[model samples]
Target: MTSRRLFLSTILAGLTVPALARAALSGAQQAAVDRVTDWMKGLKTLSATFVQIAPSGALTTGRLWIQRPGEMRMQYDPPANILLVTTDWRLVFYDGTTKQVNYIPVAQTPLGFLLARNPDFGDEVLIRDVEVTGGEIRITAFSKGNEDQGSVQLVFAEKPVELRRWTVFDPGGTKTVVTLSDVRTNQDIDQELFVWRDPQLFGYPDLD
Candidate 1:
């Protein structure tokens, strides 16, 4: 059985950031970061279909539901048998294959800053690089005081300022790229989507 801790550790171990000889965010870069932060904080709810490519190139498809200020659910497709959710203070992982649930303190995960009440580009997260290419804004950052935890790169489409995809690089230099499609924002998402239930009891059906 693959516990959540083991899974997370496998992807998030031995990560380090190389110091870059760069100055503070330029005026344009700062504006772009602020635009993204402002857009992110204004999002109350978001739902989308996602394709996640793991470091080893394994792919998983899922539906993602997010409610800001600390709530989210990533429900994987068949054969994956995984559900990752976040609450105010914890990150929960449900394994449908083994009917086991794992919990980790939110503060220990990069998700903590992402789901914060006011996710900004400073302090909690240090914006490392910002670029604009083909009408898309790419912002990369690492958790402050814990750069070894890994890094997050967020890509947004401009004109409408929509989040298109994000890539997470774990400590071992393994990258997980998630691309979003069919996104619906600020919609009324059901509270139950964020709730954790025993898959064997009434949720996901087990694979025989």
Candidate 2:
């Protein structure tokens, strides 16, 4: 797979699974899951700087903007020349180097959970594990019926429970880690950021 596709597949994290049983969770674990769910539901808009470690261990930096119930954008720094935008239930990926654009349904991506109007630990998403340590909470999960498609672990700070980072484990056992910094939540984000203008058609502009 191309690097961008790999990155996306890792993010998708096997949302195509047919059916699987939900893991049993203790009361505390259930509470933790609820907290994260509630937090995501309350999050309307967010902007952050992110550092992503690809499966090959290459590190890249980018800016991220998110508007819940269906919009997000990630723009990589120079040399990477990549942009990922999610809007209208579809993910549009633009490769500046190749001047190519590809679209995939948002429902196929793990991000669908975060973009959902009301995210819950329901049958579509199963909590594989949960851990609390060193003032952080980590929740690991995967789509039902497909343990082989890999899992995603979201790390959050305690106390107020803020999202810090997330790690995606691909089917081949490779992992991608994305850490967020300077995160601002419930802030106004320019709606244009989520707009996907095909660079191939419009001529490339400074996307940053």
Candidate 3:
């Protein structure tokens, strides 16, 4: 696949998963995941600037927004020509360069679980591995029923308890890492940000 395609796949991989390296979590590991999950569940809304590094070594920058109960938006920078939005179990990928949008079901992705009203790591979503090192906690997880799909690694900083980065491992075994900066949690993100409309209004081709 091309670099752009690989990168896009990685981004979408965030919500999808396959099999993972099975390991039981220790007391500390369980506590760490609990802490992170608590923080995430409490987040009413979040806005952040993100830097994404694709496995192919391609880099991209974007703005991100998330709300509870399955709502999210990723607006890529110019020349990237992509907008990813998820709402009500639907993930819409808009190709600004081509004026086409592809719709996906959020139920098929692990992300749907995270965006639920109560984000819990339960049957369908299982913890794979946990690592704590140098004030950082990394938790890896994969979807249970879809063990062959892929996995995601979420990195968090301790002490202040902040989410630092996330890495998505796609089915092709490509890792796409996204780092968050200038993060503002529980902010008043405008509802309109989640709306997906035709890009032609912004001077791109009409939606197909």
Candidate 4:
């Protein structure tokens, strides 16, 4: 059997098993994704904390704020003071010293779909699990073998359809956990909040 088929079957099979380590889904749960997606799609602003585990098992944490399908701001903690910002049309990187924001088109960024609610599930992501707990609905997506990507899990809440969290597991077993706590969903955020400017005007662009 080819590695691709083997990988695909493994994930699909897991979706039927009742293990946290494996994927699992229900008919009712399948419907849950639409609900969850709608909730995330409605959100105009969000805040979260993220913990990333690299391939070497080194862990890093950060605080993040995101607004709508476009804007986001993140500040990585300790040993890494990287502040990453983005808008619907561009990604901005803020370094400590020379403060010129690096920009990239949203269309060229894979994260665009990942951050958006109506994700293209057929291409790179497949719904594998859905569950509801307390007031939150959880949806898990495993990347199709062909996409050569990792698994991503998302959590949504009732009424207002607010998204609360997401988990990503890379093929190498590295993990990135994001929690959107103390979030305000559907808040009317100003468009100017997404715009970024050069930090050099302050003469201390890369201050730690």
lDDT of each: 0.73, 0.78, 0.75, 0.54
Stretches off by above 4 angstroms in model 1 are 1-23, 204-208
- Alpha carbon deviation, residue 176, candidate 2 (Å): 0.6
User: Which tens-of-lDDT digit does each residue in 1-208 have in candidate 2?
Assistant: 6666656565666643224524678898888888888888899998899998987778989898889989988888878878889988899887787677788887667677778777787767778778888988898777776655767788998779888998887767778899999999998878888888876676444544
Report the lDDT tens digits of candidate 4 across residue range 88-183: 557666654333345555433334554654554544455666777787887776544434445566677756567666665555544555555566
True-structure lDDT of candidate 4: 0.54
Clash count, predicted structure 1: 1
lDDT order, best first, reads: 2, 3, 1, 4
Cα deviation of 147 in candidate 2 (Å)?
4.5
Candidate 1 local lDDT, 37-125, one digit each (tens): 88988989888998978766778788888898789888888787788778756878787767787787765665556567878766556
Colliding pairs, model 4: 15-23, 39-161, 96-205, 96-206, 97-206
Model 2, runs deviating above 4 Å:
15-21, 201-208
lDDT of 1 at 155: 91
Q: Which residue pairs show collisions in model 1?
A: 15-171
Winner by lDDT: 2
- Please report how far candidate 1 places residue 140 from its true position, in Å: 0.8
Candidate 3 TM-score, true structure as reference: 0.88
